[model samples]
Target: MPFINLKTLLRRESVGGALLVVAALVALIWANSPWAGGYEAFRSFTVILPVHAWAADGLLAIFFFVVGNELKQEFVRGELRHPRRAVLPIVASVCGAVVPALIFAVITFGHGDAAGGWGIPMATDIAFAVSVLAVVGRGLPPALRTFLLTLAIVDDLVAIMVIAVFYSAGLAWAPLLGAVAGLALFGWLQQGPMRRGPLRQGPLTRGPLRRGPLRRGPLRGLPQRQLPMKIVLVPLAVLVWTLMHESGIHATIAGVALGLLMRTSTLPGETISPSDRAEHLIRPWTTAVILPIFALTSAGVTVTGAGNLLASPAAIGILAGLIVGKIVGIFGGAWCTTRFTRAELHPDLTWPDIFGIAQLAGIGFTVSLLIAELSYPNDLGLLESAKAAVLLASGIAATLATVTLTLRAARHRRRAPDPAG
Candidate 1:
């Protein structure tokens, strides 16, 4: 397919963010309105599959797939390819996750049930953060965006590991093993073509896939060696996803596995990489549809009373962890990394810029809400409170970060030389 321009991609993401906010607002209003009973009934009335489950497990899988592809491309061909350059963001991301969790734990201490929501604050919603940065920090260095992207990617990697290791329930050994085998096969298929397919002898038999063939005029007689992606890769992806779901792990892991296993090279005739192709194909849907539906479903928090929301320890912990903890953790972690190691901040970024970006990272919306649900499955009250806190903290963080970044942007604009001069 055609490659999307970078500016266009960023613009789309900004629109996606706006849509997310609108969807969540609609949900919140519908849930809290006098017709709240109707909204509740609609959410509760399940058909073949619950709308809630479809949004969380099914739609979010596409989001994770896009995320996985991004991480793979970054490591293989983008910013995270170099260890020296990646070190600062990696360190900052780790500290960013750890501090929030620790703060949540400390605040919710002694409340055994509430403490489980620690992971709620550990995620940085990339869509919201990126949207805010792109809009308000237009005059900022591109490297700042790179830093935030890398940091958020690493933060997501940590969140995924936590979900896999901590949140999964009811271990089923047989399906787990099957998932492993399926993932292995998926990886092998990407590296080399299926033995029975036409691809068995052509591209894979020769060397790494190359761009030259596709760029050159189509050869009339060259045997098509690559298996049709729909016929082979799609089914394998479905099987792997099913196996993972049955294994009591989050099915989204399948998307991540498939994405990381994708091949980025072509054997002389290919112009697009499997990873990039998957991204281009899947990203538009995830951003525009899946995420908005998810926000609509998961963000419907009916505020019974101010006291109820304020009294919940889980909510308070999440609020503090996101607002206070993220700023301290990310900025402090960056500071410590620079102090101990030779790693330096981007040349164009000042301390205030880092502080603003750290605040932006705290605007955790979609993933945080998902984690809140998973954190407390039985307790509807706790779930609503946690959701409320996420919304509250995210709003505060967005406003504060926008103000901070806008000031910095204005300073840059004023200092810029006039063309007329």
Candidate 2:
């Protein structure tokens, strides 16, 4: 429940972003090199699932789980606990998504089947955006970072909704029902009746058996000892995910569902809630292993025909949406919020700071690639073009953000009194 300051969070995300870039670069090199055929073979080779599917479905589920946990914690106990504090970023996030999709649609409408790829530009890669901010806007206020975090979190939640509702295959009723039941049970188990007795202190201590005044009904019969969370929770989570996967809804939805349903609070004696423990255990794995693996497999767009790829309608639409739409949508949304509501930008920040952050939000690397693959599943050329566009747009966005932020930082430094004074 301790507050992690913004700088610390940005530092952690920057590390992940660096790893992601490295992995993606390696993939691009390997895919375009003479070893391209071997890379394709390895990715297509199936165990229980194709290697690419494992990276996208299995590993990415862990990443989404962490995302869900963070969002839930924010809503339940962090900056988003208050509605007034949360509304600006939520509005900004919505506009950010809507404008990009609209731009993509308009740009690709006349092209064959390219309009379906509208969702590709709507996502903001939180890691990459935060990394850019950390590197170039170190002098910026922490509140700016918080705003970016909130915006990204809401953006991710919207992206998940789009994937679940738009991208999923036709539903299989039986497994769908099973997935629902499993999710409900998971929620119930985590919401186990609140402890009644004077809560025990410390992580390891067991609660007293005798009921106290604080003790309530229904939970009275339960033993004071903590439930075997691993034995009960893990299997149920797996069951839900499997059912969800078989139901033709992306399996990652199950991860988000379970994470949102998890308890953010535990009894006084408990060391950590399921949400905290799970995030702590898997965060490093997701950052260092899962995401890198995904990048290695998914970012390998063979750019043999670089000019053709860049000139493709899909690529043009994606680039336009990311580079132009994101900045307009995000900044416009924030400007409108300030104009119409009591919400305001941080005292230390200027319009230029918001613009820079908006530019960085265009770095829609991971989620954009996922949406691209889903959008053009049957068209290899289109998929490759879309992926290349994402890389290009992300790079351009990062560069613009870096320049703008550095100038802004330098301006602030100049206006400050010298330390020798």
Candidate 3:
């Protein structure tokens, strides 16, 4: 491969999954080291909110923004454009979430306080899951990634709803109304006079900048363009995010709302839609910088009370939910949906592929840690223990998925038509 292509593959591909693990490992080591006090102090230090809070709310919101964009694109022109294809992920995502919550609740039963953390394992960290697939799944059907993406997106939506409804400290109506109005405006602006397909929008459709020879002016040589972001876009986005935060709505929803509302059709004179362009521009940054930073801050759990963490109902619930509940829920839901409904697995895939993907879903890291932070704000010991368990479960899930997917890919490779023919 050329240098640029190789560089891009590293930055944009499954290598990020490995990077996430490295960052978390660094944090875990630091937190449990002789300098553990430094980690705690840094974690607790605040500007407006503590370091962990900013990571969970602010950094993770950026991550979800990309997810929202993916969700909209899939709905617009990808696998989700058809009802038959969409049903599998939608059902499986729900079952995947519900089963984990049920398991967590059952495990934590008789302890009402610990049971509140039931929401922790109900999420799948798509970044980790997709990246893991990309890394170890060389000869696997491409459709498997699509299936994983669709399932993860649906479950992400479910997770967002859970945070908004079940986890919010208290709902404040006025700011929420303002947030709704702001989001509406954003959608309207992006969808401006657009139709089924690409149409004219910018300078090309208007004034002197329309097809012509170079005009004589100081700015004549420059390509004519709009700068709405500098003028209104960024401020409007900040205002919406602030309103959502003020409304006690788990501010990440603002990212999802804006992302879902993005117009996915290209405008005339553009090669790609605005959403794709934004994702292309932002995804690498989020994957490389934002996710690792969030991991560093949130995964820094001291292991002084290892025995206590093992015994804690909250921690045990998280472990059981991700390790067991996710696989059973996701795979079972998928199997039933395919068996009973008209929908079927892609021709390129098989049950083993689905099983591997289901196992990947068990790697709940980013959103899981965020929910853990939300679920036990008052109980520091419980919070750390839960976070520790999330790290542990995610690590184990990643290992299991690697073994399964690697074997599946090897089998597929062995069965391939010989290029020597």
| Candidate with maximal lDDT | 3
Candidate 3 TM-score, C-alpha based:
0.84
Q: For each candidate, give its TM-score against the true structure.
A: 0.81, 0.80, 0.84
By TM-score, is 1 or 2 better? 1
Q: Which tens-of-lDDT digit does each residue in 175-251 have in candidate 2? A: 99999999988888786543333344444443443322334555443334444667787899889988988887768
Sorted by TM-score (best first), the order is 3, 1, 2
lDDT of 1 by residue, 146-181 (tens): 788778877877886787778866578798799899
Ten-residue stretch with the least lDDT total in model 3 = 192-201
Off by over 4 Å in 2: 1-11, 130-146, 163-169, 193-223, 344-350, 377-380, 405-421
Residue 41 in model 2: shift from native, Å?
2.5
- Report lDDT per candidate: 0.77, 0.78, 0.80
Clashing pairs in model 1, backbone N/Cα/C closer than 3 A: 199-225, 209-266, 209-267, 210-266, 210-267, 210-268, 213-268
Better by lDDT, candidate 2 or 1: 2
Query: Which has the greatest TM-score?
Result: 3
Stretches of model 3 off by over 4 angstroms after superposition: 1-11, 193-231, 377-381, 415-421
Better of 2 and 3 by TM-score: 3
